[model samples]
Target: MKGFVKNYSGIIWLLTGIALGSIAGLIFGKKVEVLKPIGDIFLNLLFTAVIPLVFFAISSAIANIKPSDKLSRMMGFTAIVFLATVLISAILTIVAVKIFPIHEALGNAQLSEKIEDSPFAEQLTKLFTTTEFYELLSRKSMLAMIIFSIMIGFAALKAGKAADQFVGFLHSGNEVFKGVFILIMKAGPIGLGAYFAYQVGVFGPQLFGTYAKSLGLYYGFGAFYFVVMFSVYAFVAGGIKGIRRYWKNNLIPSATAVGTCSSIAVIPSNLDAAKKMGIPEYIANVTIPLGATLHKDGSSISSIVKMAVVFALFGKGFDTADAIVLALGMTVLVSVVEGGIPNGGYVGELLFISAYGLPIEALPPAMIIGTLVDPMATLLNATGDTVASMVVTRFTEGRQWIDKAI
Candidate 1:
């Protein structure tokens, strides 16, 4: 039994969960929904551990990066890659709209009462929102903590020897939490099975109509972006061989992202992949998590698509200027107060409405798009995070990271 579990633990446990949960959900539906707490327990555990896990991992990664010309280049290159992916996504969104256009304006959308849009300054400040240390620890503010962690990392680098003890403590904590995360993953089949079962049971039928068409575009764009963007980044970094090697290694994170539907959920998997690929811990630790927090290519694509759908439904005409605003809005909104859990910062969709001057009624349907696209968007986001890290590592170190395990 031990040998069999060891041989196929990750795949077997999780897959069994999915299959069983889905079957049960199909048969019993809302009745089996009672088990949602089983899945919630695992998810909540991960969510709680991730705050500190990401903080220390990112801080240590940055601090340990020796100051040099390459470090400067790495920062610059990372930004370029991050923005490039998003910009490319914006472009693809135009194509996706043309290919799979949302013809009907949001007809069924109801006005939302909870329309709390933040100031641009407030949104930007949220990234480094350390004024209230407790707020930074919150789930909605993970990206904010990431910014603070990077700052701490730079300080540790300057402290050099004096910061060793502090840095070592962070390093130790990183390892410990990773182990805890693995232990938690053992329960993933149980938890995720229940979650997936309930989800499919409830929402599964919606996939057949208008929802399916839009979702197809969302997921279709994700696949196109991964193949093209990751391939392009890999080719530039290494070559055809590098692209081949990269695709070979990224299957797990790709699946995990699609399965989990949360970029934050796949951090441990990305870190593990980076380790097996022989990526430097400093580069992997910083880029993987930071990318999870910030580089939201999939979300960007979803935002653009949602914007197009809303504009079409409203019978609004879009000039190149409106398209540009959408591009910039998505980039900025996702960069700061990204849409997801902890704080429910749907600022990106809010930006969509505000930037284009759409009526309040559009938000309900726009939000519906956001919900359906989460998993597909997350998969692309996770895959891009690792690929972007690889590109950064190559340019900084002057060689591609050949997947040693491959």
Candidate 2:
């Protein structure tokens, strides 16, 4: 139907592009590698734009904050719950990948750099702060830029009325760069399609196996998290009665999220589910919307899986303690910023590449994984908001609030 196409137009176009490219790769084999330059141009544009885009988007979101006592309390609880759940998801995926390692399905792409030896203190300094401002302009300095941006936002907040104009400028810049990314994403289908063609041509059919294995890993764990973890959260929120009410009312929201492949789109369904589940209006109102932007358990899981696949392909061991810690930290950051802009999935991809110091050639595969995993990710991201609202209610209103609301 027309409505269906309208809703999924972006996905349709991308899939179509990938399909066409795959056919070309199949037919021409290595000859299709000629199309890689087009993909490189697209990746280069993204790399060039992402640093400023991150600076403005994060800074503006923080700078525009309007403080209120109730809002602060709610936000404090919400941040705790959101970050905790996302971390839990990341940790679970790490455990799973260790048990059954992600196979190198994308052929042996020599895209990763060997992590340089450095003292722990030195590495920490570089991760959080750059020596010069110009260094923040590079994607490799992503975490440092994030730290700097947050500092600026908080400083602007501390300035009060005097910084109002500056806050507005940050907002304007965010919008401008957002528009710039949109313009770039208009070429996504062609670029990604060509990229896929080259990958399939060079890597051959094994590419499909890697994609399938990673997807299966994510979906299997995503389902477990959705079913088991949510039940536990609901029980913690309201006991046995809470679990019943949550599942009874959460189906529509889950369906809407999976169907739309968008957390923002499922807001209405989530609100309705929250109301039906006996979440306080204030809690649901704040948590659902904020969670759409901030909480992303599914993305955390998928990002870990993507990193595992990339590590396997690059002949690196992912089980190192330092690597796991860094992946968890990066996963949390990626989840927070995942929905910060249009075509924001690419932002997460770039973040992973930069944080891990992988070459830009690693981006296309990461992007492909993100696209394929989006619907399930949206399912967890959107529905988790509703469950998180329940947890917030338990903390703010006590255990018996659920009984009282019903």
Candidate 3:
């Protein structure tokens, strides 16, 4: 009974924080403007941990696996799952926009003028062709960080006994970053409360429903994607019962991700659940953490859906070729690049808006609607990670390679 109460307390606190924040925002939204700073602080804390965490975690995980044959296989499997997920998401976004257009009734406000002032196009161009060091320390780019970490890790592994001290240092750094992540996440209720209040104060409850419908459509499509993909994993690896069991064990982690709207905060629980479900520890360690950092089916999908909404609102009819290309490219690139960054959805959406030279006035509306849609996006991301893991596990056939000390 005591344990049950303790477990329930976390959920209660999360709900209470959300409620209080919303109420506060509704009452003093325009005057106080307190939520943005608090949210920013929260984001800062998250970003501080991202770089070191990615560097250490990826280095350590890759260093432990041997023979290098399985490495190629794992990379291939991950790439396929990542691309497939993005494609499905793009198709869903296109269909949703066609069927239940969001921007149909919005007021006509010229957005091109606003788009010209923003830095999104420039940022996108920079991302396509930047040196590793420039991207890592200067731009703080996620793709750059992953590439640098992987290269160093591979080097460390190849160095034999000489790299032992350096590998130990990375492992220690990973531990420290993980500890910091926990400390920050414990304050989640407060952050959620403050942000929610600000949102309600600024937008009111009526806007909630409108945003919710768009979010609902995205999640509905995401659910379809998850089911279909998991069915394939089941057919390939285990049967229906195995898949069902996997889902049963994963429910807690999934629900936590949905409620918190944070895959980073849910990582420990996800790792634990993966192990309990009989996923090999090596696979779980390598894939789950890597997936959390790289696989973002939800954010990629939501970016496209939101872009469609923006177009509809502006009365700009979709260009079939551009829309298809944007949806597919944005989903994959954003999923891969933005996955490691904190506030990934926020950053990804801003980048998307800027990249396409969308109007700035639309940003406020996008921010409001985007925040509302985030939890669903987080849910999709968490589910995508699970599906990716299952696929990788199957592809690898649960084979265990001996870990060699560098």
Candidate 4:
């Protein structure tokens, strides 16, 4: 039993969490509200490590660049690919919402207070600030910290031995936090199960049916998108055989993405899959690390779903040209800042309430859609990250290069 668990702890924990949460939710129904604390505790624990996690993760990735020239080229190509996917995903998401058409009526506003309005210029500036150095610990301003960390990483490249020592320390901390993250995940089944249970208890399985249509539409679109995009890219990079090989090797990473619902959490598994698929170390390393945060195609699609759902629930329409642009802009913004935010699930809520000027009542539904689509979103994002590396390797090196067994 010990050997079995030691070998399959991740798989075991994931299945257990799902089963427990589902059972609990069904047994207690709305009474599962009592389990809220258990879920919240898990969320809080994840939150506590996020600050250190972001700082070290980003900085370490940047600090490893041996030559600035290579860094620039890799970043330029990866960024172009990442941006293209995000832009296209956002456009498609809008189209999907239009095709499906959520017709739910608006409910009363949930919260009375509003975020103090800021000029659009100020909001853009807030995305990367020079001030509020201390607030990063509490995640009051993550965008600023991301900016700061990047600057630090670039500076470390030129600062010589002292900088190397500092970055080494940072990398060490990054590894420690990664280990901490995995440790926390050991409790995932308990935490997420309870969280899901609380959700089920409050809303009941019947309630999911109300959301299943709109959310289901998004998932269906995601499946179609994945099959088409990944199949094309995989075949382009490695041929028909390559396509089969990529999927065969990708099972572990895909499951991890769904189970953990975290891009960073699945990094190790993704890295292993990349090696199995025979992508070069240079391409895989840089792309996967940066892509995890910046390449959020899933979030882009989810943001569209979020805005579309929120607008419908708020009695607004995506009818006018202005409404369409607002949806596009909000989708892009939410997806971009998502990786930078702590407990980024609130990202949709923050943008809708503050930027789009939707009433607070839209928040609950936004939150609901976020929870429902997250696993799929993460799965798409993770898969995209791997495929990106494959494409990059094929471009930089050659074609039909990977093994099917992998």
Candidate 5:
């Protein structure tokens, strides 16, 4: 018992805090919201540190790879696996919504502010590139920052001996940021507890009728995917043995993701889990951080739910052939570009409204759903990266990769 407690002390404290906060929320109601600032502080600290963390971690991974072929192969397998998993998630959501139908009347909510829908080309341009260097410092330009980091990494790799010091600096910076992440996480118990208090206390009663129905479907589907689909991915990656290994090491990251509700914030835990699962350092380093930015299975699922709900609100059918095709495509794109931050679905929600030519009034409901489901969505998005690393390892290192890792 002592050994078990020692091993899981952090998780224990976190869960304890969450449990206490939830009870307080239930008993005290809206008054519990006063604790929300602690949670906000925690999230703010993470967002502030994440940009540099991503830059240093990704660039350092690229710079340290001596063989270009190895890097290329890993990247290739990573892309294939990411696409496969995200598409599977989107497809599963579509099928679920179709079988059980989730759309209901969300009532008429007026839009106070006009939405200036940008052109698709301009949106894509902004997604990948920023005019000013300082803009990349913001979380909104996460994809652009990732792209810039990759370019810098390649430049350093090609620069050969002259870039040795630069590469070392990158490594040092990566270590420093990682240390920063650890320091921030030390406050997870109180921070996440306070956040959960506000969520349950302030927003608890708002879930009713259609909103409750949508959440049930989303939460149900999310649970099924998290358990069944993740298990399937694990088995395929390493058979029965893989399944055992994955679940054993996944709990920490899973809980952390649920508590934090941010994929980028969960990267450290996922990377640590990947290591314990015997994933190669190179694969874990590249895939986990990059996956946080580029891959979002959970968001893909939410995108479909949001679309179906919007379609239903407008008294339109979501099951039309064109709607399904367009929704799946947009979900894939949205998953790639969405920030790994909390409530990152805002941009994707706007895009969804614009793509379907829906009224700006449609945005608020979807955003509400996004917020309500963000924790579970983030759980799948963040933890999926670890299993994805295993899948990538399976492909790149061959079928016997798990045995070799052991």
Candidate 6:
């Protein structure tokens, strides 16, 4: 029963979130604005943990690799898999946006009136220059922090005895973060429930239909992308047999991620599933957990797709160089650096929008569409972590290690 519960907990949470969201939506239909603060609090909680969580996890993972050469190979493989997944997901999202263009214009006369009255443009400029600077300073931007931490961690690894001590400290710190993360995850359902309720209450039934086409496109592409990627991963990992057990075991984590829309919360289940795959405990501990911080295939893909949609909506074309940079930068920024915090989806998108000086008014529409697509993005993310765990385990501990463990 305990094992069964663990395996299906994600599904449970997802259903709970949906049910609660519906109830909240109905009850608070006219008071959605009041519930916005609750959503904001949840988002803040998720974001607050991201920087430290990522720094320690990645540093510790890198520090634990035995042979330096093996670490290099693992990093290389991780990079390739991460990049490939992001690119593929982005392409699928872009295609989907093009095929199913959401052209429904805003009919709210008051919306333009409100926009004109608001000082949002001035605030946005301030946010772009000042707030963004602070974000960079505090390592709020995942990409910058990731680059800094990786360089620092690598340097520490090479610093002989001093580095060893520091790395050990980071490993210990990573454990502390893990403990905090666990506590937060245990509270996830309630927090998510509140958020969903707020969303439903605020948007009402009418808004759902308004955003339906865009949302549908996002979800449709997300699903298709996940299916294709999962198939490829299974094939590469040695056919159905190697991946069969994993597929069966992925239910809880995948469901949890989908329901919560929070990848970080599913780390424990991901680690458990990786262990069940005959991945060595040492490898699983490092890779599965670390992957949670950096392996955001879904988020990266979704961001690209969202960006393309935004561009299309505005009748703009992506500059080739800019697109490449944005795609790669966002992949690293949001995944390897930011860590998989809840509401990270919003933060990452915001970072991209602000970094490139994109219009702020476009965000609301993009978010509405993106949320619908998010579940698939999260599913792909969890699947990527599972596949990455196998790849890293095989490379680090060797094929013989996996065979022997099995």
All candidates: TM-score: 0.57, 0.95, 0.61, 0.63, 0.62, 0.60
Ranking by lDDT: 2, 5, 4, 1, 3, 6
Clashes of each: 1, 0, 7, 3, 0, 2
Predicted candidate 3 versus true structure: per-residue lDDT over 1-406, tens digit per residue: 5644564465466567776777777778655465667755664665566556656767775565466565677767767876776677677677776787655543333233222222445545454445545557432355455566778889988987899898888778767766776677567578666666655675565545556667777777778766675566544545565466567777888787866667776788788777666666767777777778677777766777777666654445554665566557756756764564444554555445544545433444454455656666777777667656766776676532111100
Model 5: per-residue Cα lDDT over 229-298, one tens digit each: 9999999999999999999999999988876667887899999999999999999999999899888989
What is candidate 2's lDDT per residue for 311-368, written digit by digit as tens? Answer: 7666555777887888898899998887768867779989888877777888877888
Clashing pairs for predicted structure model 5, backbone only: none
- Candidate lDDT values, in order: 0.66, 0.85, 0.63, 0.69, 0.78, 0.60
Who is ahead in lDDT, 3 or 4? 4
Who is ahead in TM-score, 2 or 4?
A: 2
Task: Give the runs in model 3 whose Cα sits over 4 Å from its true position.
Answer: 1-15, 34-36, 68-82, 103-124, 128-135, 138-140, 203-206, 226-406
Of 2 and 3, the candidate ahead on lDDT is: 2
Predicted structure with the largest TM-score when compared to the true one: 2
Residue-level lDDT of model 1, residues 83-166, one tens digit each, is 877777877777767766654533433122333334545655554465787888776665566678879989888898999999
Give lDDT tens digits, candidate 4, residues 1-406. 5654554465456557756786788887888888878877866776576567767766776787676676677667777777777888888777777777754432332123333434556655654564655765654455566667788788887786778788898789778877776677667678777776876666556434546676887899899878887787788778887788688888999888876777887789989998888887778888887778777778888777777666655556556676666566656556655663443655445544445556434544565566667778889888788887777776666554565324
lDDT of 5 at 98: 78
**Ten-residue segment with the worst summed lDDT in candidate 4?**
105-114
Clashing pairs in 4: 17-189, 29-201, 30-201
**Model 4 bad stretches (over 4 Å):** 1-32, 68-75, 101-122, 202-206, 227-406
Per-model root-mean-square deviation over C-alphas: 9.2, 1.8, 7.4, 6.7, 8.2, 7.4
- Whichever of 1 and 2 has more lDDT, that candidate is 2
Best by lDDT: 2
